[model samples]
Target: MDIKEKIRNFIESNLIVFEDEAVFTDDDNIFQMGFVNSLFAMKLLGYIEQEFGITVANEDLDIANFSTLNSIVRLIGKHKQEV
Candidate 1:
């Protein structure tokens, strides 16, 4: 229902590989967890923009912003404030 839970659900649902869902946490490094590939990050970027109505700038695209639920939430908050 919250942002973290929404992100966690989205990532788990979109995962290409079937791994133990229990392995994910709000702060889990999704990339390090092997939950996504590079292109998937782009897909997630689009989802963030559409779902949160925030545009992520080119400079903001990086693992530091997309690698965890909490980080994505932070990125969304940052962009929302810029609106």
Candidate 2:
């Protein structure tokens, strides 16, 4: 699957919302919407690093980087380029 799809699937799997209730676009802030908890951010960080073979540095641990699907994708893209 593509990067967005992979990240989408991972986010969906961890969602606090039911399948029917889980409605979000790539630009939506899942964290602000309460779709996931703060702990999920750590899981997402690990997933992004391992799945994409990119390391997330200490300076890149901003919540804004992981708040939305689009943001997460952008963060991954940035790190992938660094790799």
Question: Which model scores highest in lDDT?
Answer: 2
Error of 1 at 1 (Å): 2.2
Relative to the true structure, how large is the alpha-carbon lDDT of every model? Answer: 0.84, 0.93
**Per-residue lDDT of 1-83 in model 1, one digit per residue for the tens?**
97777778888888977766547777888888777888889889889989988888989987789998889989988888899
Lowest-lDDT window of 10 residues in candidate 2? Answer: 74-83
TM-score winner among the candidates? Answer: 2
lDDT of 1: 0.84
Give lDDT tens digits, candidate 2, residues 1-83: 89999999999999998888889999999988999999999999999989999999899899999999999999999988887
TM-score of each: 0.87, 0.96
Candidate 1, run of 10 with poorest lDDT? 16-25
- RMSD of each candidate relative to the true structure: 1.5, 0.7
Error of 2 at 7 (Å): 0.1
